[model samples]
Target chain A: MTTAEVSAPTTEKPKRDKPMGTETRVAWTFIAPGAALLLLFIVAPFVLAIWFSLTNQRLISPLPTRFVGFENYLGELADPLFWKSLWNNFRFAAFVVPAQTAFALLLAVFVNQRIAGRVIFRTIYFTPITVVMAAAATIWVLLFNVNGLVNGFFELITFGNFAPDWLNDPTWAMWAIIVVSIWQGVGFQMVILLAALQDVPGELYEAASIDGAGAWKQFTNITVPGIRNALIFVFTVTTILAMRLFDQPTLMPRSPGGPLDSTRTTMVHMVDLGFGRQAIGRGSAIAVIFFVIVLILTLIQRRFLKEESAQ
Target chain B: MTADSDVRVSAKKSVGANPLWRWVLYSVMIVLAAFFLFPLVYMVASSLIPDDQVLAKSQSFEAFVPTPFVGLENFSDAIERANLPRVFANSVIISGLIVSLGLVVNSLFGYALARLRFPGRKLLVGVVVALIIIPFEALAVPLLFMGAQVGWLDTYQIQILPFIASPLFIFLFYTFFLSIPRSLEEAAMIDGASPVEIFTRVVAPLAKPAYATVAILGFLFSWGQFLWPSIVTRGVDVRPLPVGIGVFATTPPVSWGDIMAYTVLMTLPLLVIFLIFQRQFVQGVASSGVKG
Candidate 1:
């Protein structure tokens, strides 16, 4: 065939390619309902929240609302409770992210093996994650009760009458919530890591074994680098989850912030201010601030992980 | 066959000498598994004990043994006392509606992103990625206000409406749809099938795995939802299981056995579904790959 024959076929295909067609319209039709729902439920509310945050709003009021320029933001910034909860949130994140990520990775490495009963072990490890929120919280509440299982265990280990109210004592409540959070969240991190671990090529391990590398050497040089992307993913997710801490404290605490606001995470504080105290503007400001903090932390995390990967 | 023969020879020669290493491996795994399993065993053990004995150190571990096993009395009392049945029904309705709506909505939005030629498509994607980071806590107050304005507070509408469309689900579906080879759809179109018919018959069926992933995740999030429902549903009239269980914590004369029974009840449906989709669920999550 001549060069012209081949070039003619390509030109003909371009000419005959059906005109921008009905598929596009059909796609929009199928997509509109969901798009519209998101606009109403999510996008619209977000805009309304910004507006509400700028005004002195009340849940039950017919009074004319007036805009106050940055007053709510300033007020929340100055408020001791707001700052305290913000600090507590940092502490919660500091403890949870490292603890859960390390523990999950350790568990995954041990269990991702060709061993007997591994399936059963995996299921047993992941079962607490499936426990519904309320049930899990209640069980923990019982476990942390002044004379609860934890105290009982502590007493038995100490060989004496040694019981401190795990949830009630101000010093211990936040730690109690952190412990349960790790228990509930580590399963998710483990599954992600395990899946990544399994994806590493078996040939790489065999190659390392041929070089007389022990398991520890092989893990550091091969497995860690192989699953580095997954490590970043799990770390980011756990950090996000830790920052969004709410339900654990709200459920476990005797009050909104048990024992002197020790367990009062920022999310819980925002809810308490907005709903419990009926300060919608203050609550919205807190939420907006909360969003900003999370955005900054996430950006910092991404940059740090990128640098780590580059190194 | 070569490696098998070699491994057999090596295994017979080395088995006796590796006893310490084998014990170490098994012991480490056993300890690690126990760490993960401890809380659950404690939860079950605590739940079976009498209310007084639940918090009392006087009772030994023997008290928690299932010997004089209490019948389903704990479950019935928990159901009545915590008003669990109503909450369970509410949870079912809310989660079911969200899952159904999410499947339809996400598939549609995903298809649009995959194939449509709409303006600002890139911009919309950007908005969604940003929104994923804006924690749900940030949206709670605004959603609550929006729901109240529409006369949806204290109703199932408030519980189900805010979550009907998940950005995470949309992102997953969009990626899945994009991966599908275009030839299949092109062939359908050439055969004179309309876009709607082609999509329903070709694209939709091929996207089953994606749909299943979206459904299970949507259901889990809605089922596990706590804060939004609590904020919107002020009364017991429309509260779901999580809220019901939260209220259970504050009630006087709380029953440990019944509370455990309630916990068991709450976890049953989700556990069944997770087990059923265990393989697919794992694949789906892993394939999403580095997403929130």
Candidate 2:
């Protein structure tokens, strides 16, 4: 059957080699709608982003737009709020990526065990990922209230000494967002890592145990290397998501990027400028710069993954 | 034996072999589960009670339980005050359009890229793959500009159209189509089936998993979409549920019970779908993670 299947396609290779006939026409016709949308939405907008960044454009301005090359970029860099927003993006990714990754791996490992009701446990763990971020933020805003459940728990645990206003206090506001982000995001990474964990051959664990390897040692030597690609993938994806933080911060805080701008991510900043302030040129510059930062981070991650795999 | 001990015995060869260690693990898991579940449970509980009682009960364990139950008044109030029924309809229409239209367009594009011998097929695939890395947030400003320029802003098409032809979904369908055996298509060709017919009959049926993955992901994405909709949509006319609920939550004279009710109303549909299709949801997410 395998030989027959292999030969069948090759047997018709002569007829398939003809260029730009009905096949090409049919293919292009099939592809036209999606291709047009992609070009219009993605490609053209990307090109316009660069062009708009170099001009003095406003969402609604009386003055005609003109070329002001790199001024927008320079002005954005000079602004302290832009730096604060960029730092917040980095700060968010810095905490969320590692913390969420570790928690997810822990949950994955726990659910990967042969314990009964592990499926139930996994389903419960992954429930948050299915909840819309806006709803999740709304749910959490109540919990993060001054006299809310979280503070109630803290008061109980700390004997009534340490309950802070979570979303209002500048010191605690970013941490509140970070905690909510991790709580909401960890399940997604856990699900992926759990799949990867299942793919790691059972024999490897059995073999390691037979060789008298301890659990931690087996994890580092066997399990880590086994799911290395997945680990890196989860890390990179989580980092990208953390950098793109918008919805939670937008919805959870007293205002979008409020509590003295404690959680103003770059995406939130770009939106605030482009739409809220109507500074389209500056917003476009921020968008372009943000894209470059994410692109650079992704490239760096790819190179790092490549080097690690090469070794 | 209790279910816990049954789990312990069944998992003997597993890491939780020793009873003491098993107890510890179970304890930790129970704590974690409570931590994960308490907020959601509290939201539901709060949604069922009066607005005043929600904050009053927060300091005690009673917060997790519905007390002085006002029944579904909060939900009704949420619907009335937030104009939720219209927002709900808007969300359903927008997400439905995106998911349905996306499946057809992306799947067709993917199928062509996978099977057809076209002039720029390789280049198109590469471009799609490259496009996947460009986050939508980066393009939102320019897209907004373009939307405003062409008067596409504050319209359903602005939200639905930009997202319908996703590079990631296209690539997902492309890869899935590639994995279908060549012999099946060859046989269909021998039977005098056109490319379109072959896709509809032979190929699409086999690609149900791919379609399900895309549909679920697309619906979830479109339904939960916050930034883009919040940008383009200025009125409740075309505003989806997430942004509606968000604006409702932030508006003054806040009622925790009503907000929770709104949130539950926003979240319940997806949660029900998720529970029913939990395995597919997990597998879809996992496969996307692994492949992408």
Candidate 3:
């Protein structure tokens, strides 16, 4: 065909492409209910929260509610427990996020193999994903209790030489939270990574093996890069979740903070401040700050991920 | 030739194929599996043991083994003392309403964003998508303030209404619906069906996977939730299972076995439902790439 004939087919098709002919009236009607809910629940609460964070509001006190102009924010910064929980929150996230990511990635690699009982193993590992945080928290509390199965196993392995109070001891309480979190959380990321792994071509591995790359080398080079999007997604999510870590720590502590505030997390501190003391202003301030952290962390992760993909 | 190849396949499948490596992988998985199960298995085994036995074994890994003696005292006490039945029913009702209503509302919104052209459609989609990352804790205080002002507190509507149209669920449905061909909706339009009719009869039915995903994820989320219910509701009238379990921690005469028993009772229903529809759950969560 002539060049004009070939170009004509592509050029003319754009004009004939059907218009997206949806009616706006019907569309508005369809979105109305959900839009209303989002407005009332998500948006309204978010706006109100920022407003409340500036006030001296109490849940049921006779004190008149009035704006305090970031006093809650300043007050929280000075409060030792607030700062302690902030560090504790960061410490918890730092410990759990990388551990869970590495653990899940390793698991995804193993189960991604054409191994025996993969189905059974996947199911077994994923049981915790279905568990309520409250339920998982209860079980872990028992296991971490002095002389419970957790310590018993430690002692058994050490020939009766070691056992620590996993829950009550400040030194071990944070680690207990970390370990159970890894247990409860790994299955989720593993499942995501496993799906990501399936998208990697078998031929890539074959080519690497033929080129004399060892399993670890092939994994680092091929598998990791292939699932880069998923890795970022999982890591970012795990971090955000770790920041808000509650339920597990909440159940472990006799008080809001695990003995001496060891296992206290940011959101848990916010909850204690907000509901326990009915200090709505400070609690709202804490939440708003944490929300900013989550927002920034998520955006940075997305940017980093985009750069990786762009590379 | 077929029989010979089948024999080779069986050999490859067996632990004998690569005996050493196979053994290592198997042992690793088994060990890992046992580690994963340790908390839950311990819970069940500990719950079966008498409170005294559980306490006695609390310091040992031997605590994992159900005692030489066992009884249902924990289960009975949990049922009686904690008012387990009431909370369980309350949780079921709340989860049920949220899941069922949630599917309809979210799917409708998702459908609009996916298939329709409207004024501010892009803006609305942006709003929903943006709200997805704002954790409920961030919203709780103000939501409480809002709920109390509207007299929604101490009621099921307070919990149900706020969550019924989850931004994430809408996004999930939107993703699923976006992949659906416009031709299908067009065909229904040509048949003179109204938009809602086209949605309900044509669009919704074809989106079975989306529905299943939304249902399972919604159920798990609504059930697993502690923060919101803990914030909104008080007294036994509207308390969910998790909150029910939590309140006992502060109350006097706390019994560990009873707590474990309640945990088991609270957890078993969800586990069973999840297992029954696990494929849908996994597939739903897989594409969403985030746990509810």
Top-TM-score structure, candidate number = 2
- Please, what is the TM-score per model? 0.90, 0.94, 0.91
lDDT (0-100) at residue B204 of candidate 3?
91
Error of 1 at A275 (Å): 0.6
- Candidate 2 per-residue lDDT, tens place, B1-292, comes to 3754554334335576677877887778878888788878988999999988888888789998899999999999999988988899999999999999999999999999999876556777878988998899989998998899889888999989999999999999999999989999889989999888999999999999999999988887888999999999988889999989755655456788898899899989999999999999998888888785
Off by over 4 Å in 2: A1-20, A308-311, B1-14, B246-252
Candidate 1 CAPRI level: acceptable
Ranking by TM-score: 2, 3, 1
Residue A73 lDDT, candidate 1, scale 0-100:
94
Clashing residue pairs for model 1: none
Lowest summed lDDT window (length 10), candidate 2 chain B? B3-12
DockQ of 2: 0.51
Ranked by lDDT, the better of candidates 1 and 3 is: 3
Report every candidate's CA lDDT. Answer: 0.76, 0.87, 0.81
Please give the TM-score of chain B in predicted model 3. 0.88
Ranking by lDDT: 2, 3, 1
